[model samples]
Target: MTLTSTAPNVFEAGLPTFTYGLTATPHDILDDLRTAQSCAPIAIGPLGPEILSYSMARELLRDNRFRLPPGITLAAQGITSGPLFDKLTSSLLGLNGAPHIRLRKLVSKAFTPRATSRLQDTIREVMNGLIDHVVDAGRCDVVPDIARPYPTPIICALLGAPPEDWPLFVAWTEEIFKAFNFQPDVNFDESAIMRAWGELDDYVDGMVAERRHNLTDDLLSELIRAESDGDRLNLDELRMLAAGFLMAGTDTTRNQLAASVQVLCEHPDQWETLRDHPDLAMQAVEETMRHSPAASIVPRAATEDVEFGGYLFPEGTFILVNTFAANRDPAIYDDADRFDITREDAPAILTFGGGAHYCLGANLARRELAEALVVLTRRLSAPRLVGPAPWKSLLGMTGPTTLPIEFASERL
Candidate 1:
């Protein structure tokens, strides 16, 4: 594959291109990526790791040679030791090989189809209750009013966290998510991050202690008692796992829900399709995920010097898989840029990372999204955007911070 003419323009413009650890306007960047995808399956930069194409992105995720970078913990960039250091270091996202395999196995049970199936009623109740709050008003900001609050109670219930502590968990997760920004030049407040981590650690430790004495049906208790082949998660591992699950399930689901509503409102035809064929809730969620995945970029590092797509990626090279780009790769999907729920061969989207590190909470996230759409379409009619939805500027997850929508007023 050869580099396209647009490649030179990306570097010359100095606009903090997507691969350069900076957040660009996603639509514009995606257009550039689609053009580039036609020319090559991979593009190697002067100083950075290779930028993967749609096919290459899927391949590299399953490839063992490319592993998560070591020391990439939630302890901020420069801090070596802190409250979040041990927890983040022990997280499933930060580990590989035997450790990652072991932790994932223990936690995977909670997110299984059977397990999430049990939460169907609870999820429906949560969605309906949220809709009840805004139904009378006839309009509401999707982010704070609906999407932001919908998942917390469910996540808390799954984790055996106290419902009252939902607000605190939200605060801590916000601070923790900042550590995920991969931009090399971004500045983070080490002190505030450490403080949040400290408080969260103490809270999680208390929950662990309580669950150890009295196991319950919740996920946290299950993790405490979970054993396989005489192996179990240690104290620190339990705390980190609980915290990680909370953070992982919360913000990403919030963003995806908001994005789905924004997209559906913008495309009335698609919204009507969902409203008419409520059974297509899953397809609508999948379409939203394909069109606008929560996390646009995922980072990985080469464990060893290896050649991929005819380029030599040296050991320790940082690779950024532009998921937003690959999801829209024209070669992979017909009319890839358009939002169409009825695409027969929709092709799997990499919104959730693939292979050994596939998202543990994927089932739960899907259930939440499907249920939210089902309830919304059934309760509200002719939902449309009140104004332009503004997106968050973070380089990691891409979604609207405020998505205001107005719909025909009707009471269930």
Candidate 2:
């Protein structure tokens, strides 16, 4: 995979023109985008959409004039859709303004400080149990063995689904996310994606129906009972929210966990620092979020003519905020490219985004990553990567698809 930028012509003097090859990986593309960001905070290019830097990206996300475009659809983009499209487009991620606010308010309770704090013990137990499975083996692939398997169960428990059904959830999510790939030349298996979506939708609908008859002490049940003023989520909204929570909460965390482990292993000094001072696990998680964000890009569309950073963006212009670059902005962090867990004053990264559309599961993700690190460091002695971790080529989400590690066997 190769990415090359041609020298700017006379008219577009300062701006570099990027040309991305079909084989370019997401990280490679991001590297090019970061270089472009350094040249200018905002750049207009021929190959891709306009790219925004850290400050400008933050501004664009917070501004009401920039919104999630309604015209963007899986079907319109030549991808088949069924319940997946309906659920995602109707959920909080797809909406803006009052409707988004109302749904967010209702859903926020499940992710509050108190709520997430209560799950620490559960998360710890889950992580340790996963480690326990591989402790005797002395070697394991962290992605499939641990990271990929951990989050779905935790999210399932929170969503009032059976923990035993996590593997099924993972399978469905894998298929559904295929439709999310944005690389220019990638081809998704539309039939498989739609099939998985239908199965997942029916499964969620069943859970919703069961919950309505007999509510339980779970986030899904609470959402079912939740009322804002005189309004409540309709059946479609309920199903969508439940499915969205599972998908959104699990996917990013799964990738982040794998990426975090890969980063820690690559930088042994940092890993040792974390191992020695277990309290710094959270800091390590923050640093990982900054240095190697799992979700690399966020897309937005201008609702009205906006002029900023010496560029005029007409309404409907799509903006791609390169968070992978923004988090590594040299202006924002001293020695930004280096991964240092001890840095105390690092600014918040755009990994979870900003303003109105900030990730609802941010706290949960932080806790999960921190807990995974704590357990890994505590249970294993100097775990080393088996080889170079292979990162996924997906555009929006970037992380190791396989992270094999070997460590001294230790009893829990």
- TM-score on alpha carbons, each prediction: 0.87, 0.87
**Residue 30 in candidate 1, Cα distance off native in Å:** 1.9
lDDT of 1 by residue, 137-182 (tens): 9999999899988887788878777767878977887777766654
In candidate 2, which residue ranges exceed 4 Å CA deviation? 1-14, 26-34, 45-52, 70-77, 80-87, 183-192
- True-structure RMSD, every candidate: 4.9, 5.2
lDDT agreement of model 1 with the native: 0.75
Model 2, span 1-412: residue lDDT tens: 1213343322244565575653345567666777777777766544345554678778777888777654254643554446656655776778888889988988875455655566777888899899889999999999989998888888877776776787888888878776555543254666787788788888988888898899877777778888878788887787778777877888799899999888888888887788889899889999998887788777777676656455556556777676777777787789878889999877778889888989988878888889889888878777898876878753556788788899886734
**Clash-forming residue pairs, model 2:** none
lDDT of each: 0.75, 0.75
